[model samples]
Target chain A: MAWFGRHGDGAEHRPRGRGREPQRVERVGLDDLTPDPIAVLGQAAYLQLGHFEALSRAASTAPTLEAKGSLSAAAGKVLAKHSAIIAELDSRGADSSAAMSVHTAAIDRYFEMVQGADWYEDLASIYFTSGLLDDFFGRITGNLDGGAKISASISSDAGSEDIVQLLADGMSKDPRLASRLAVWGRRLVGDTLLMARSALPHPVNPPAGEARIEPVLTELMADHTRRMDRLGLTA
Target chain B: MAWFGRHGDGAEHRPRGRGREPQRVERVGLDDLTPDPIAVLGQAAYLQLGHFEALSRAASTAPTLEAKGSLSAAAGKVLAKHSAIIAELDSRGADSSAAMSVHTAAIDRYFEMVQGADWYEDLASIYFTSGLLDDFFGRITGNLDGGAKISASISSDAGSEDIVQLLADGMSKDPRLASRLAVWGRRLVGDTLLMARSALPHPVNPPAGEARIEPVLTELMADHTRRMDRLGLTA
Candidate 1:
């Protein structure tokens, strides 16, 4: 009753973040050998849940009331998005929890490994990972039937808007923070990419799936680079 | 811009919890010599922020993803309400952070002392304190102009509906849980009352403030009783 229900056919998808204009949606020329719809929804929704969770933790430990206030709102927005994904699953007649529980272990593991040593690193972790994942999902969701509208409906800024501001503020205050966060920001991408790769179906014939995902991954990285550039950090 | 900017003149307020019709708002007619408007808003808003933080922690540690999903949504709602309060402060031309930061240490201290030993206890902690404080704030908010509209504007649940349901479900599954949580619920009230009392202004003649607050506290307790009754627990 709790975990086995698959209400939706699992094709649901949506984008998140500071609500940046999605990069060229039609330019990626990958084939339509898609993964299981439930896999996509479950993995995707759980990742959003993961971000919401991570952000919630960051908000709790945030040093300033202002940071707590803004970060909490951003975290709220992310969780609301996660709930919307679960609700979509429910509408499909899937047990929402069941749809997402499958990915709980992997998502939890990612959060555990990526927990930052301080607020700046934590914010950087949130910025880089959410930046990459949201862009990747924005593309995937864009391809889904109603995803474009859903993507458009969310706040124009990705949830990372505050992160970018806070990091910039911090880096400006202490030059060391900039260099250290740049390193941290770069370190985040490797795990983030691995997690993104996990969201896709495991390739039965490695090259076939690899060939399809390679271009998409490149776009995601490029998007990540752009976000880092906004903070004046190297990707 | 971030702190010390008072936007609203300190009259904004709202209620939260399971969408129960506010308990006898007309009947709890204690005198209107309330605490400073800014003080009330900051303390109330920061208290909600603290719950959001505490619940965020709970969701992170929740053993099951189902709990995480519901807790996270409830947390988001709380944070949104907190943000709305801040927005009201912003509208009044107040620095939301400066307004809230004054009570941050006090609110933070309460949260630190009241944290539960486990998820069940945590849920109960959320249930009891939010039940009590929301009722108190609801009373205060109801008395202010435009407050009822904003209170009503929020989701019918006090953001604790999920918490109530989850706790009820958990206790039924484990008799020991219900008993332990009942005890935990009682222990929570002492600290919660002290915190609530601290929210009001100090009087030159202490009995005057205490006199008005006594009846109000009584009503808050009755409301807590009603909420606890729902859980088949003693207040």
Candidate 2:
């Protein structure tokens, strides 16, 4: 289920720096190497929409007003980000609807595969699954420009930190829940990886002139591992 | 299940006019006559939160992206309004959490009673249920001043027109849906009235110095009938 193309032999190494500088690369323009901006943005919108749905569901199922409030706030942020992406797409004269349609089936299928049974599981899914996706977007969009950057930035900061904290707080109160959530986290990541590979566009030919997605995947996994450790889970 | 107090004998009639002018009345101040602003605003927030839940649910169930987008937009607006109401309560030194707790059971019960089965029903629920509530708020708050006015005004314009149009469009496409929705609309109003009467703070004693709530109920029902007419539903 690997979606990334392998780098060709003798690919140039680029210096790594921080603060939004496009990563240095060899053999292709970063724009050409990256996935189509429309597709990326469209997939982003679909994902945010999914987050909105999940948060709303969690809010309804939440046993307490405080939990419902927290979930509602998270959902609101997702909606705002989704709206910003749509506006960015509109400004670029891109057909957001068409782009969204392209990945809707895969995104919907992923959600169907990972429906949570309770509020805690829902929160776990958001904290782990969405956290990884946000980090992944941040990494992949590092080399993009213009509307792609704007759209990606809109989604890259999904405000899941609050949800993560909430989940952590919940687990802290009931340490036994941590073990169950650790298992849930594993399932979430497994389903996420499967979905990503199946849903995201894949490079057909050898990685020359195409963005090497392997490094991005590796970075995402490393971040996910750190997040799991923070949540008292084995990655 | 009636929550309103009776009007004092021989209370002078105030002339009705448009635009923010406080209505004229004899013997009682509007603020004294109205429900506590904090309570009203709190209930409004709860209702808006419910709308957010319903809209998000509808968006997920919607068959098309266009429908999902519309529902998302509506949810976003409700969130913004709820935030504004919360801020207003905060500025007034009212405890929003405490206020919200006062009506949580009633609001939850209302939702439990009027749960929508599908997207169209959800849309109708938003249109008829929320629309009537907004009108009732507007009528009751006509005499309120300052923060009370601002808070009520925030809730009074729930932006349900778009949802109403969505429902009307859906009904136009399938006329048979109208009869079903007409019945649904009746159930919505009945449940709403039952909830309102049960949840709202009632004046324990009869009419002396109490603002007349019967007139306001009559007015709300009349306006609701007009809205029903607009939707081509029999009141």
Q: How do the residues A66-94 of candidate 2 rate in per-residue lDDT, one tens digit apiece?
A: 77887888888878878877876787688
- The prediction achieving the highest DockQ against the true structure is 2
Model 1: residues >4 Å from true position, as ranges? A1-32, A153-156, A203-205, B1-32, B151-156
Question: lDDT (CA) for every model shown?
Answer: 0.69, 0.68
DockQ of 2: 0.74
Per-prediction count of colliding residue pairs?
32, 0
Cα lDDT tens digits, model 1, A1-235, are: 1001112111111133334332322122123334555566677788888888788888888888778777887887777667766765666577777878888888888887777888788888888887777766555655555555444423235457778889999988999988897788777888889987776666565654465567566667787888889999876
lDDT of 1 by residue, B1-235 (tens): 1001122211112133324333332222222345566677778789888888888888877777777877887787777778777777787778888899888888888988889888888888888887777766655655555566434423235557778888888888888887888788778888988887786666444554455457556666677678778889876
Best by lDDT: 1
- Native contacts, share recovered per candidate: 0.96, 0.84
Q: Candidate 2 has what TM-score?
A: 0.84
DockQ for every prediction shown: 0.62, 0.74
